[model samples]
Target: MKGRIVGVVLAAGASRRFGARDKLAARISGRAMVQAPARALSGLGLSRRAAITRTPRQPHALRGTGTALWSVGHRRPQAASLRRAVRGARATGASHLLIVLGDMPGIGRAELRALLRHGGLHPAMATDGRSLAPPALIPRRIFGPLLRLRGDRGAGALLRRRPDLRRVPLGAGALRDVDRPEDLRPPRTG
Candidate 1:
């Protein structure tokens, strides 16, 4: 909580399962999917913020969100995008990196605050009690491992194997991410 933390949004996924349309561009509750996470990160006042996307041009939703947009090859692996973010953070002298998925509109300011509050200098990830995932906080010590990550995988597998990883419990619904069209639908009310 005391060090310079850089917030990064990983938005370069191929969205192969979400039909021909771009999942991150899809809207939920009147806002673009990617905008939610980007906006959330912007509100935290991190030392720096960026979004890694597959498009060279900045998306309209992210234009005024205060997150610098970096592009990667659409076919590139998830690790490639992560490496880019890590390098940017390192260049900026950040002490920690907050990794958030652009497709996950469910994770908002509250969930992120909890992760940082409990994370401190240790690697911390959000959990729904059954599985570990991001919006994760990675201290500078683990940036090496993150740079070595390969093929479609982010820090999930690496964090899982770390004994020092802190699991911040969040509501299951808060971890929901958009993969398919139906995933954008609001849950039914009783």
Candidate 2:
């Protein structure tokens, strides 16, 4: 079945904890880390529904092809950015939203598509058998909860507030993201 979900790439973050630069803009496989998530979403046919970024004054390089550029208000937390993304997704008549992170360079398109096929209104979250985070496929039924998100944590907190979360295992790549200088370095070619 076709997933009615639109993809939202959260490319807005301060990266203050990392302290080098915007980690999402850091490179991987000859492209910015943000590009990986953007490409993955494009591959899934959600390119037309994407919100590439929520930071104003960023280089055009950060904005991938066919993605809408938006600012979630500077100095705001990640949840604010998420709220903006969900609103955009809803505006496009999407039944669900696949929230992909800007720093998750290793998330495969197929895995996301698998989760999409199984998505539902009870909050289908991508987990690595340990913790859950984006890329989460949130149904429109949870849009109100998403709008109520706070700080930079995003929707994982919502799962706690609302029981009955459908957990989808994304394996190792789902648990990975570019958070430090070392994280952006290319893995050794064996």
Candidate 3:
């Protein structure tokens, strides 16, 4: 039987490079950048949809996109926040957790579904041919090590330890995360 799958949007980035504005709150295609991933994951009808923030006052838009709000308290590292989100997801009886990045406004429902398909059997993560990263599906078997993660390393450390990560090929759209002002530009036309 397939285990329950939960979605968690990691929205706690400091956006130090974005210059004076939170990238997740920046508008992309007329909507908050975080909304894209939130909607994509929520549309999958996962066991639950949630967003992790560094503080309580971050932004209120994610909640409207159907994601429950969570905070890791003050400016904790991404890994710490993710660890807390994982524990919260497990509490919902989830056997799998889909870690989505809030800044990836181009991620869509189809991409999330693709990750979910392989994630049911083993740990799966999306790859843009250069690196395997979030928009990943982590199985419960590694939840312990995941919870043990600390500092700003995020999940890369855990992924590196396990060579079994199923790398799912994803399009440039799925990999386009908004980190700086230039990233907010409109996509070029064919």
Whole-model Cα lDDT of every candidate shown, in order = 0.89, 0.73, 0.82
RMSD in Å for all candidates: 1.2, 2.6, 1.9
Candidate 2 residue-wise lDDT, 108-185, digit = tens: 787688677667656677778877767788888888878987886687787656667778888765558777787765
> Cα miss at 53, model 3 (Å)?
1.2
- What C-alpha lDDT does candidate 3 achieve relative to the native structure? 0.82
- What ranking emerges by TM-score with the best candidate at the front? 1, 3, 2
Candidate 1 stretches greater than 4 Å from native = none
Whole-model alpha-carbon lDDT for candidate 2:
0.73
Instruction: Give candidate 1's error at residue 36 in angstroms.
Output: 0.6
TM-score of predicted structure 2: 0.86
Instruction: State candidate 3's TM-score.
Output: 0.92
* Top lDDT model: 1
How many clashing residue pairs are found in candidate 2?
Answer: 0
1 or 3, greater by TM-score: 1
The backbone clash count of each candidate, in order, is 0, 0, 0
Q: Model 3, range 1-190, lDDT digits (tens) per residue?
A: 2678888999888888899976887887788899999999765768888888887764766757877888887767778888988898889988888898989988999988888777766788888888877788888888888898888878766775677888888988778878889988876869
* Candidate number with the higher lDDT (2 or 3): 3
